[model samples]
Target: MGENINFNIVLFEPEIPQNTGNIGRTCVLTNCKLHLIKPLGFSLDEKQVRRAGLDYWKDVDVEIHESFEELRKKYKDGVFYFCTTKGKKYHTDVKYNRGDFLVFGKESAGLPDEVRNSDPDRCIRVPMINTTDRSLNLSNTVAIIAYEALRQVEFPNMK
Candidate 1:
């Protein structure tokens, strides 16, 4: 696919059904594609997921990948941005473009050390007052960065 969707939201080994479901809903409302990596914590057909996504869950443009490497190999030329707590820069510091991939991590562990450190410059994070405390919810984190990207591009195809 050549620049089919405005943006891509990739959840790597997401562990929470409700978080994934809420992220799916966000993707639908923002006109972004949702990609779920392998080893999902909950089944897509789970009731909790549908309940969280509400009626719009069926309308979400979602793709399931066996692995992150599979997705990367498929989209070799795609631009990818990693979301991690280890990032030195804020999500707003980057300039997003159409077809860019925003890769998010799982709820508990987050992106692996290798992935997060692979491209330090490409990694970004949301600002928080307390670093030692709990991180933001996975859904909230995705929404924040996705909206920022959408905002940068003036929210194309969205009202």
Candidate 2:
């Protein structure tokens, strides 16, 4: 009945194939785009991904970008919000809508300095429990944020 609200999940040099696969599944279920920035730690067809994502890959709409710069140029006007453990703003507070690009950093180092500092004000994070050394899994975190965004837009039933 109305235009579907689309969100983009950008993975910056993702290290874990399974995590990427899980994120892909989330995108498929939520009706969003998943962007992978190379060079990835493993091939997209790696065993871990196939196992984790099951048979969802066929239906997943995934875009592979050569670099972060490519995504920046393509989505210059869209809001790019980097999700990091060190982000100043909480992910829940950000008003997500259609056309928002939510970017996540690598598994090992999180986001690089250039990316983390590029748009300090837009980066966001999910608040973690106290006394924890690490944050939520990359794919898990994306699911949380992406679903919230989809929910905000009212999850319209598109035929």
lDDT of each: 0.90, 0.85
TM-scores of all candidate predictions against the true structure: 0.96, 0.91
Per-residue lDDT over 48-147 for candidate 2, one digit per residue giving the tens place of the 0 to 100 score: 9877788998888788999999988887777889999888899888888787899999999999989889999988998888654788989889988887
Per lDDT, the best of the predicted structures is 1
Off by over 4 Å in 1: none
Determine the backbone clash count of candidate 1.
Answer: 0
Clashes of each: 0, 0
lDDT of 2 at 124: 92
Model 2: lDDT of residue 136 = 90
Give model 2 RMSD, 1 decimal. 2.6
